[model samples]
Target chain A: MDRPASFLDEALSLDDGDSNNLQPWIGRVVLVEDCVETNGAFVLHHLIKRFLSPNLSSSDSIVIFVAFAQPFSHYDRILLPLGDRQGEGVPSKEAKRDIGDMDWRDLVTGLELAWVGGLGFAELGCNLVVQRENKRLIFFDMLMLECPDDGVEDGIIALYGNIQKAVEAVSSLNKNITIMIDDISLLEVAANGSTKDVLDFMHYCHTLTTQFACTIITVIHEDIYSSADHFTLPLQMEHLADIKIKAEPLVTGLAADVHGQLTILNKGSSDGLGRWKSKIRNFHYRVKENSVEYFYPGGRT
Target chain B: MATNKGRTSSFSRNFSAAPTSSIPGLKYGPNGTIFLSSGVPDLDKILGGGFHLGSLVMIMEDTEAPHHMLLLRNFMSQGLVHNQPILYASPSTNPRAFLGTLPTMLVSKDDRSRNTDAEQKDLRIAWQYKKYLGENKPHIEERDGKVEYCNEFDLRKPIEKHLIMGNRVECISLLDCSSLAGFRNSCSKFLSQLPRYDGNITSAGRIAIQSLCAPQCEYFDKEWDMLSFIRSLKSMVRSSNAVAFLTFPASLVSPSVSKRWQHLADTLLSVKAIPDEDKELANLLTGYQDMLGLLSVHKVARFNTQVPVILDATTYSIKLQKRRSLVLECLNQAPVDGSSGSSYGTSGSCSGSSKTGTLDF
Candidate 1:
C-alpha cells in the first residue's frame, strides 16, 4: 500500500509549496463544537472527501462513518451526486463524457457505515456489507441486534465492541482508517445522560488513535448543556483533543455578507517556548455546491 | 518590614485563589467574564452580552399589552436553536401553542444573495483568493473581516431534530397542581431532573416560569405558600447552573409582593405599552413613527463590580421590526406636553437628561 497524498493541502490550501510536508491531523483526535445555527456537517463532508482522495491506494485506505443522529440514506444523498442530474449543465460534449466515465462510488474503498438508529439500514436499501471483488462498504445496524436492556449503557458497550472489531478487521487488511462520529450527544443519550460514561468512551477513543495510528473526528453541539457542570463532557473532550474546531454563525446575523465562522486550534503545535502552545485561526466560511469555501472575514479580491 | 509583610500576603492570596474555569452555557467575552446570548443580539449587547449564568432575570409585563411574551418566545427560540434544553413552566398557556407562536427563523441577507448571479460570482472570486492566502496572512485580516460582534439565532428553522427526539422540552403546567404543596413538589422534581437530563454539553439549561405572580396568587391558598415557593425556587437557581426567567404581571401583584420578587431577581426588566395619548409624545421624543412600547431595565445583577452597567434605568422605545428583531432606542428628546410630561419625564431622566439638556442649550 502506498502513502496517500494529503487532502488537507488541496482542500484547505494548507500547502506551503512543499509537497513532502504532511499535516499533523493524522493519528490525532479532533472535536468540533457545532450548533443548529452553525452547521458542522460541511466540515465532516470535506474531511470524508479528503480521506477518499484519489492519491491513496483504493485497497489500503478506508473510511468509517458512524451515523447516530441521522440515517445512512441521508448520508448517501450528501456524499453521492444525484444520478439523474449528473451532466445537466455541461456545455461541452467532452465534459459530459468525463462525467459519465466517473465512477463516483469507487472514490473510496473499504467504506463502512455504522447506523445506530432504531430503523435498520436494510430498510433504506443499504446492505449489511458490500464486498465486491476488491472493494467493500460495510453497514452495521445496532437496532437489528438484541440488547440486554433499554438502558444507554448496554447500547454504548455494544457500539464500542463493534467499532473495535471493525478497526481490528481493517487494520488486519493493512488499511489506514479515518473514523467520524456524527454526534457525540447521541452517545450521551445512549448512556442515559451521563457525561461520565461519554468521557470513559472518549478515553477509549483517544487510546485507539494513539495505539492504532488512526484519526477520529467527532462533533458535539455546545448548546446541549447550559451550565459548566453539564459541560464536563465537551470540556474534557476539548482537553483530550489534539485539535479543536468551533463552528458558529456569523455574529452580524447571517447576512449575504458572510455565512459562518470556523475557529480552528492546533493544540499540539507550539511556539519556541517549552509550554504547550496552540495556533488559532478563524475563517469565515460559506458552503457552495461543490466545495466549502473559507476566507478571511473581510478579505476582498 | 512592612513591604516584606505586604509581599507575603499578596503571594498567599494568589496561591489561595482557585483557577477560574470558563463559564458553561456562555461565550467568553474579550473581557474576563462570560456572556450568554438573550436570543436577541441587541438585547444581549444592552445587557452586557446577555444575562450571566446562574442569574435570575425577571420580566415584569403590563397585563394590558402582554407584548413582552415575544421576548420570552425569543429567549426560548434562541435556546432551541443553540440546542439548549428549555424547562418552561406556564400556568395558563398551552405549551404547544406557545411553541407555535414563535417567529420563524430570520432570513439573513446572505440567504437571499444565493439567488443572485453577482453574489455567486463574488463568492467564486473570494474562494480563489482564500485558496491563495491560506493561513499565511496576518490574523488582523480575519479580525477586520468580522462584521458583527453578536451571534444571531434563526427562529425560522425548526429546533435540531435530535433535541426534539430526545424530549428536550420539559413543559410543566402549574395550572394542574391542585395544592401549593403539589406545585412545590412538581417544581422540585422538574428542577432535580434538569442537571441529569443535560447530556455532554456544559451549558446550563434555561428555566422560564411565566406569570409567577398571577398564577401563584390563585394556586396557593395562603400567602405564605407563595412566598415559600419563591424562596425555594431562588435557592434552587443559586445552587444550580440554570438561568431562570420569571415573568410576573405587575398589575396583579401588590407593590410589596412585587418588591420581594424584584429583590429576589438578579436583573429586572419592565415592559409597558405606550398609551394612545402618549403616542404623540413618544413620536416627538424618539423621532420614530412606529414606537410600540416602553422598556425599562430597572436592575442589572452586579456579579462583577469592575463590569460597567450594561443597561441602566434608561427608557427605550420598543419597535418590532420586520425581521422580528426587538429594537430598543433611547428617547432622543423629552416630552414637551405637560400633561404627559410627568410620566415620561421621571422614567426618562436617567438616559434622556443628557440629550434633552444638550438640545436645550
Candidate 2:
C-alpha cells in the first residue's frame, strides 16, 4: 500500500495485494506475447522485480528463470536500479497528482486510486545478482541447448527434467514459487520446431502449477502466430494463461515518448463457484532508463 | 539514458572495464559488447555501430531483385578484410566461386580525400549541414593499418584471389547438404572454433548464410527445420564471439513462417527492389534513377539491454555511390509545384535542408 501503483499493477490487480488470494499471480499462468517492432521482455523483467524485490512483502516469491532468449547478465543489468539518482519508476517530482492536463480518473482506471503522497519512493528493480547469491533465484541458461538430430526430444526432455527437479526442490520451501520462461518460440526451436514437444513441455509445466503453489509465466512472439492454431504454440499457451499480456507497437506508429502499448487480458481467477470472468486492460507505456511509465490513451502528463 | 549507467557508476560503462581489444574492424559498444562492421559504413552507422559480436542478423531478401546479395557480399568481404573467420553458406553449387565477386576495399585514403574535394565542389556549404543536423555523426573511418574497422568497397574491382585463399574463409554450398542437419553440423563445427567472451573477446567470427530457405535447397519446404536451424544458429552465435547473418526471401515462404524468422532475428532488415519505370514513384522522390533498391531496418539488435532502438527513418534508398561502394541515403521527396515538399530529413527536420531544389546535390 505504501508504493505507488503503476497502471501495470492495476491491470494485473497487483495493487490490491490483500483483497484477493494472498497472491493473485500464484497458482496462475501469465503469457506475454510481442512482435518484432516491440519487445515484451520488459514485462518479464518487471515481474521478476515485483516478486523478488523484498519491498513487496505480500508477493515475495522465488523465481525460476528458464531463459531461452537472453543470458543472466542481460536480466541482471536491466533489473538493477538505474543508478543512484533515479528511484523505482515514480520520481517524486513527476508523482505530483496535479498535472493540469491529466485527470485523476485516467491515472488508474478511474478507481479513485490517486497518488497518496507516494513521494515515499523506493527505487524500482532489485539486484538480481544478490538474489541469485541468496539461492532465491534459479537460472537455467539454455542459450546453448542444441538438440541432436538423432531424436528431437533428447535435449528438451533433459531440460524439462532439470526444470522439474529444480521446481520440486524449491517447492519444499514455504515461499510461493513462480516459474518464468523467457520465451516459448525459442523452445520450439530447441525442440527442433516440434510444437508437440513444446506443448508437451508446457503441459509438464502446468502439472507443476497444480502440484505446487506455483505460477507459470511465458513469452511468445505473437506476430509469428498473428495470422494463423493460430500457431499451436501460442494457442496452447493462450488456453493455459490466466492472464495474457500483449505488447504491440502503437496503431499509428513509433514515437519517442511512447514506447508501446500493453494489453492485459485477465481471465479472472477462480472463485468459490469456480466461475470465470475475463477482463481486459489496455494502456500505453513508455520505458525509461530506470522505470516504465504506464498511462492511458490521451492521458500522458 | 540513465538506464545505460545501471546502478553502478556511469564511468564503468562509457569507459569499458575490459581492456580495449587491439583487433581491427571492431568497435566498443555499451554493456561490454563489441560491434563488427556490417561491411557498409553508412549501414553500420545506421544500425547503431554495426552488428553486435554475438547476434542474429536476418535480411528479408526482395522477391524480384537480388539486393540482399549486395549486403551479404559486403558483410563477408569485411570479415575477409579483417581476417576474421568466415563461414558462408549459399544455395549455389560453388559458393567459393561467388567469393570471386567480392568487392575490393576502396583505396580509402586517396578516394576519401577526393570525395571531400568533390563534395566541396558540387555540394554547397548551405546544403552540407544536412549531414550533421538531422542524423547521427558519420563514423570516422580511421584506418590505422592494413586492418580497417569498416572499408568502402569498390564493387567494380574484385578482391584479390590471394586474400580469399589465404584467410580462414569457408564456403558451404547448400546443394551439397541433403538436410539442414548436415548444414547445421558444419555451422556448429565452425562456430565452435571461434573465440568466446569470457572477460574480453580476443577474436571474432562471421557467418553469412545466403538464401537459407531458398527452394533450390533440399530443406526448402520444411519450415520448422529452417526455423530451428536459425534458432540454433542464433543460440550458438550468442555464446561465441561471432555474428551470423542470414537472408531469406520473405515472398518465398508463408507469411506466418516468415514472421517466425523475423522474430528470431536480433537485427531484422528488409530490402525492396524499385521498379524501373514507376512514373509516380519517379515524381514522388528525387534521384529515382540512381536507386537500386530500398533498405528498411525493421529491428536493430539491442544486446544486453532492454531498450528498443527506434531509428529516425526505417527506410533508406540503397544507392551505389559512384556506382561502386553501396551508400544508403534518406529518401528526399521531390518539390511539388505549390506544396513545397520536404526533403531528406525524415523526422520533419526539413526546416534545416537548403532550398537547393529537390536535387539535393
Candidate 3:
C-alpha cells in the first residue's frame, strides 16, 4: 500500500474544531470485517475490544460478520480460547419445540459466545445465522449443498421464507440486531433465484428496515464476483445506512516485515469512514477503534 | 535587476504580495508554533516541537572564521531525517561538503533502533506482502527497527512516496549562509522586483543564511542602510518561518558595536569551542548544546533533557567581556546570591524557573 496523499492525511488529522457539535451516530454501530487485522472474525473481535469513545452506552450494539478466509471449523478453535459458544441453554430447533422459551441470559450468552464468541456457528458454511440473546436463529437453512432435487424455484421460496421468518423473529425480540451473512454472493447463487427474485429480496430488506425499527448491516467482500452480487442489493437501502466505512491495507514500521495487504469493506454507507468528502477548507472525520491513525509531523495538536 | 525594478514600481502601486495567503503551505496552531512532525521524535523535539511555521528563527554565532555552519548542518539533518524537500543555498561553504559528509555522518551515527519506534502499523502490511510474495529481501536490521537508506537519489522522493503510501511529513531546509554576500549585493535589485510566485525560492522552503558579514564591510555599505537592512532581512526570515543562522565573529565584532542586533532576537546564545575534542564529539555535541540552549528560551516548547551550560575554555573567556559570566549566572541552574533581580541574570529553569529568553554559553 502506498502512502496516502498529503492533503488526505491532513484531512484525517485536521480536527473538526467544533467541540459542542454532537455526533450521535458516530459510534452507534461498528462494522468489523477481515481487513488489515487477522481474518474477518479477528477483525470483529478487535473492534469489539477497541470500540472508540469510552462514553458509548452499553445499550448500543455492534454488528459484525465472520465472512472471510476460512471454513467455520477453522475459526472455532480460535473462538473457543476466547470463551464464546453459540446457543448453550436455549435448545436447537428440535429441543426448542420440546421446551418452550429458555432463559434469556442463556440465549444472550450463547449468542455472544457464538456470533461474538464461538465464531464457528455456521460450520457447514451454508446458513446465515443471527445471535440475539442466547439463541442462534438459522436464517439460511440450506447449507451449501449441490442443487436440491426440489429445484431452484423451491430453493428460492425456501430461502425467502426463512429470511422473512428470521426478520420477523428479530423484530419481535425488540433488540437491535446485527445479521451476519457469509458472502452474499454464495447466498445468491445458492438461492438459484432469478434476477427478479434477488431484486424482490432487496425490496423485502427495505421493508425490514422500516417495519422492524432496527439497524441492518451487511459485510461484503470486495472480490470482483462478490462485489457484483453486492451491487444487486438495492442502492436506495445503501443510502439509508447511518454510516459506511472502509478498511484498507496498512503498513507499519514494526510490521514492515510482513507480506500482503488486508482489505475490509463495510456495506453501510453511513459508517465513520465514508462520511468525509474532500473540501478546500475543512472536513469532518470520526475514527474507528484500531483504525489507522495519521499524525502530522510535530504533533498536529 | 530590471525585473526587480519593475516589481518595486508595482509594489509602490499595490502593497499586497498577492490575492492568496502570504505563507502558502503553512499550517498554523492556536498560538501558532509551526508543527513539523517529520515522523521523527528527536528532530521534532529538538526543534521545539517542530519549526514555528511563520516565525523567524535566528541562529547566530560570533562572526569571523568559524561561523555557525556546523549548527546549520545539524539543522539540515532534521530535514534529512524526515525526508522532506531541501533547497540548499551554498554560497560560502562547499555545497558538496553539505551534500556528501553531512548526510553520511547523520546516517552513520543514527541508531537504527530509533526508526523502529516510528508508527509501525503500516509496516506490518508491507512486510506481510514481502513474506507472502518472497519479493522483498528483508534486511537484517529491519527486525531491529531500522529504516535503511534505500538509495542516494533525492531522499524526499522516497519519503514522499512513503507519505503517499500513508506516511506524511513536511521537512525542508536551505543551506545558504555562504551566499550572504551575493544576496546582499542582489538584495537592492531583488527587492525592487516583485517576488515571483514561481521563483526558485518558493514560500515553503527553509533557509540558512550563515556568515553574516560585519556591517563596516564594503559589501554592507553598498547594499543598503544598516538598521533597515537588518529589519528587512529579519522580516523576510520571519515571514518564511525559515530557521536562519546568522554568523558573526565574536573576536572581530564588538558587543558595543551592535547591541541592537541582540535586541531583535528571541534567544541570544553563543557557541564556545569545547576543549575536549573527543568528549565534545566535533559538530554534533556542540550543535546539540546550542540548540538545547535556544530551546530553553522558547516557552512554547517543552524539552526532554535539562541542558548543561558550560563555558568553553578554549574560545569563551569570562575575562574578556564578562558576557559569558553574565549569561551563565542568569541561567544558572542552582540558586545564586545577590543576582536574583539583575537584568542580565534570569531565573531560567524548566518550569516556574524563569520566562527570560537570554542564555550565555
- For candidate 1, lDDT tens digit of each residue in A11-78? 23334454322344557787788764455766776565445443333435566667654444334434
Q: What TM-score would every model get versus the actual structure?
A: 0.42, 0.84, 0.27
Using TM-score as the measure, the top candidate is: 2
Q: Predictions ranked by TM-score, top down?
A: 2, 1, 3
- For model 1, state the Cα shift of residue A84 in Å: 18
lDDT per residue for candidate 3 within B156-267, as digits (tens), equals: 2222233222312222122332323345444323332323323222333344444444443444432213323444454444434344444444344343223334433333
Two-way lDDT contest, 1 vs 2, winner = 2
What 10-residue stretch in candidate 2 chain B is worst by lDDT? Answer: B137-146
lDDT for B56 (candidate 3): 34
- Least accurate stretch of 10 residues (summed lDDT) in model 3 chain A? A281-290
Measured against the true two-chain complex, the DockQ scores of the candidates, in the order shown, are 0.01, 0.27, 0.01
Evaluate chain B of model 3: give its TM-score.
Answer: 0.42
lDDT of 2 by residue, B127-151 (tens): 3454344322222221121236788
Q: Which candidate wins on lDDT?
A: 2
Distance from true location, Cα of A277 in model 3, Å:
68
lDDT of 2: 0.75
Give the Cα lDDT of each candidate. Answer: 0.54, 0.75, 0.32
Please give, as one word, the docking class of candidate 3: incorrect
lDDT of 1 by residue, B1-361 (tens): 2443334334323322222133333553211223455766546645645776656788899999876786787777767655677788787656555665555445573444235435534534533354344321211121111113233444344444554445477776767666556666665666666653122225557787777656444564343345445555655664455677888886675544454456546678888887776654654664455767887776665442211132222467777554345656555554443433312222423444335434543
